[model samples]
Target: MSRGAILLLAAFSGCLAAAPEATAQTNTGTAIEAGGFVNPLLPSGPDPWIVRDGSTYYYMNTQGNRLAIRKTQDITRLADAPEITVWTPPAAGPNAQSIWAPELHRIHGKWYIYYTAAASGHDDDAHRGIFVLENAGRDPTRGKWTDRGQLKTEHTGIDGTTFVYSGKRYFAYSAYVGPDSELAIVAMANPWTLQGKETIIARPDRAWERQGGRQILEGPEFLRAPNGKLYLTYSGSACWSDDYAIGLLSAPAGSDPLDATAWTKTPDPVIAKSPEQDVYAPGHNGFFTTPGDRETWIVYHANPGPGMQCTPKRSPRIQRVEWDREGRPVFAKPAGSALALPRPAGAP
Candidate 1:
């Protein structure tokens, strides 16, 4: 790292103090009444995910014990969007509690939600894994969610996300591998089931990713570059650590996603904590575009201040993706929470 970059990272390594007012403000009654909006789209939301279907967007986040989704036509006004508690787990079962990182995706005209859950009585991270739910309705907020059981994997996993490349589909997730939680991918038999053996493509090999007292590479989200390059962005380090940031793993176009050697990890985090902007531990991200706008937007969660770590203090924030000559995504520093940014293009 450059001397300047090293200094910046050093500044964010500790828990700096911040006033509560520094947190992003929320506007409830007048949604999108202004031409711009501030960060922390909502007061608190972690492991945020959004999938656009038709003209509406369905948003989900980690809500322990149950799953809920927000329906919004204008994402800038997400605070005022209608939300439905889509599915609540039973009082006791394998997936009864510790609900986290729910992602809603539509495939074959049906809606599927993949999330992390564990046995109600278990406290070990070893017991935590990914599970799926299926809904056969046009509006996910108003449908019966059928439990599809846990996604079979050799290791415990979380932050499951699915994508299609060429003509086949694959499931990407974070699997617990010894001391490090690594990113893994597997072929899918259907929207809810993994078909083959899981392949560990990325690990917490860098110093930046070894923060939070544990090595972690979770929250796998995919993006296609302007060229044929493919990118898999994931959160590194523990969510409670100030060093938590995002890393990237890329593969050549048309390469087999199941082949572990095909993917390459970037040495530095593609995005990291912006202490200057009071954005701490910015990671666990997803992507979407506006109803008519083609510009890609990246959505994730972060703390407004230091020492907040892994609490409800983290909130959803977004910025447009930038690119370089090689078509690799370039992320600038996160915007200050209080500063107003143009409401996502074409919203409301």
Candidate 2:
């Protein structure tokens, strides 16, 4: 995509946080509604991510210009949580603009945040890459965040997520190396360092990926299913289209992440625009296990309406992670804003 088109995807998610009162649930002028609470724990959230550390949940999305996080014990009431600005880039630098998909991870007893950013004056995929920040303090919001520089992969891209398989560190992200973005993986020396060649695992070669007039394979999130198998779920299609959805790729429990043949792609999208469920362009998801009973939950962003597309109107919604009888994963049509469901299994 061109720079102008890509800016539409990167810029809007940051601005939506300013005007969240568009929905009745956001008004919060009255009681917590009769039957249940609403989806979109927050008004504007794209590529929504959350990491559970002890009793607290740290949340983030595409902030566009700067990096920030919201802290809360109960993610269902995230609108009432405290937002903290953890790191701000310099006015002139490669890691200064179009910040997106900030993932807060506590790796090796230290807090590290991985996010994508473009150059100070550029907004296209060429100038964008993944960067990391380190905070030694136990409390991430209060600590000093030091810039750890970019994760130098073979190609520059966005939405980088890391995982440890077989006791070795690996990084997965969308590489903008071809006609469209493709999911790539590489070995990581540590939390902030990359030390090997990137292997292209999946591409936007399937029909379901060519939505909104563009083929996209971004937002690679690592998942370890209850069945002990491994999966890499990624957002597909153009974010600017209502067809934007999620696709799945699976590998063995203990397989080589750097080998392309180890991963198998699902022909169709696992989750997509469900008008009955009032979720449009549903993509860019993160997973977490509940505090008490360890029920897995998915936190992601979607448009309330189909016409909203990839703009700031995209808000965060969540649901439980379900598995099928065969041990494969299942992503049902999400419960819309009208349905008031119970909080996650162990939320306080």
Candidate 3:
């Protein structure tokens, strides 16, 4: 092995030592008689998105053929949470295949799910687009998710998410621009429609983003810091490779989100592969705060080893996120799969 590989191996071993009691077994497979839990809140899942409403935490993931959500009081027990199928595409329609990255949001007291899907028997770039579903009921898992139709965009896109800033709602998504995929922003007329032209905010220009021969930047999630600054976190590089990681972009709180010049990109990845921790390609993350906003946590998916190739083996994991003295978010190195972590605050 190369000298650098050897050094990383040593580092991985050291991280394991700090959490010697960590285990990779499913929640039921291991007995938890303590205050913390091990890595991989679930046995198998990918592109995980989680949100907290009231006392319940609702989790969703890319299930290939349909949309399913898991509800629980404690995120550590996600593996034991009750999952319900909320939406299924028609047998042969524009959104009948390749469902990916479903994000649930509550706007104006109604639930909205923005997701990506391709037509049946079609996986081409032209057939993929963003779609929306609405649920008017109080509880997302128990309500009827009505089809809201496809969200119009300039080209093929995926990983759509929305955020409201300065009294105006905006949408950010990853879309195809020629041979490459880049992050774009636009104004939203409502939860399901985009107005005006998209401004390409972030492109895969850095070395890490070009890894695995697929210059991709997708999965844009919004984060607002306590200092009143707006930050956009996205996954970079090819998901099919171990180099897949998370990158950041920030803008002033009052600035227009659709203005590309208003945002600045991080030179390197924030959350990435930690060889020492045995976690690879940790990206496609979502953030949620504990009840009363006492703590913040990042929920994402990663493989146990290199070359896992973006399969269901990429399981969901969570860890607490910290902030620097300047109020910027600080994501520590990815935690090893066996590392024990405290459950979210106020979790039962």
Candidate 4:
């Protein structure tokens, strides 16, 4: 792809307007007369992340040049939410180009955003590292986002996410190790600084992870199970290829997160391309709980067809995640755009 094409592909997940509501289901599994929504929540959104704070939901994704956040009470009406441009990079410097995967998190009564960016004129695969912004206010969209600077990792990194385990915080991200990208973890002394040497947790060793001749593992997200099991879900394979999919690595909740040996990788992908549904390259996901905390949902991005090549054609889609008898997550299959699923429980 040309440089212009590459930039377009990287920055296409922009904000969108609201669509009409669809049919929804109630807590009793009965269909409501009105008020549900369909897939492709937005016409274009990649690496989509969402978090619910009380009655509000904050949504973000890769906007390329700057960080923007959409806040709403009803996720089905996300397109109608007011977007705030919280941060803009310098005219020329590190973290001034290719801003992607912006995640909103709250810790210690403050808000923080973990995202990836690179210096100007650098290739997307090179020079990219994780950077953070801190906001003192309780509402992330209403506060000033201060630059906390780039995270100093041993190598270039991206898709940085944080989780608290055993009363301590840890940062997990994808870093380049030799020819392939691997998932690494380090202790966090605070929301912005990483302590101790990084531990390599997972790599692209399986055939599904090495598709398109690109050995890659990126976009690590943390999910905690009800049984106290901690799982790190990540995107594998070359994202530009339709073969891209999601894989899982798990460790007990009490286990040392920095110990690479404690984590076990799933042999196959939990979610992959479903051509019958017209959903391809489905990965780079974030998890959220419904208003009543009764349901779990996965928010991620996918292309409607094969060979979409990471452009605006790659749009955000969501589906309720189910658990098997063993309590392990079961991401059935990617739902087609035409599938009229029930709206999220407790969503107005």
Task: Output the number of the TM-score-best candidate.
Answer: 2
* lDDT (C-alpha) at residue 112 in model 3: 94
Judging by lDDT, tell me the better candidate of 1 and 2.
2
For 168-239, candidate 2 gives per-residue lDDT tens digits of 999999988766889999999989889878899998998879887777898899888766678998988888
Give the least accurate 10-residue stretch of model 4, judged by summed lDDT. 13-22
TM-score of candidate 3 relative to the true fold: 0.90
Global local distance difference test of model 2: 0.80
Instruction: Kindly report the root-mean-square deviation of model 2 from the true structure over all alpha carbons.
Output: 5.6
Model 1 C-alpha lDDT per residue in residues 1-348, reported as the tens digit of each score: 532223123222211121232322344223224576778889888889988886788888877767999998788788999678989988888888778889999999999999988787873467778899999998899878999999898888678899998889999998878767888899998987789788889888888988866778889999988787889999888777888998888899889999999998888877778877789999999998776647778899899999787766778998777666777777656776545566666676
Residue clash pairs of candidate 1: none
Model 1 residue 4 CA deviation (Å) reads 37
What C-alpha lDDT do the candidate models reach, one value each? 0.79, 0.80, 0.81, 0.81
Candidate 3, which segments miss by more than 4 Å at Cα?
1-33
lDDT of 1: 0.79
Residue 155 miss distance in model 1 (angstroms): 0.8
Model 3 lDDT per residue over 253-333, tens place: 677888889999988888889898789998899999889888888999998888876778888989887776666887766
| Residue runs of model 2 more than 4 Å from their true location after superposition | 1-36
Segments of candidate 4 deviating more than 4 angstroms: 1-33, 124-126
- Candidate 4 yields a Cα-based lDDT of 0.81
Per-candidate TM-score against the hidden true structure: 0.89, 0.91, 0.90, 0.90
What shift in Å separates residue 91 of candidate 1 from its native position after superposition? Answer: 1.6
Q: Which pairs clash in the backbone of model 3? A: 12-276
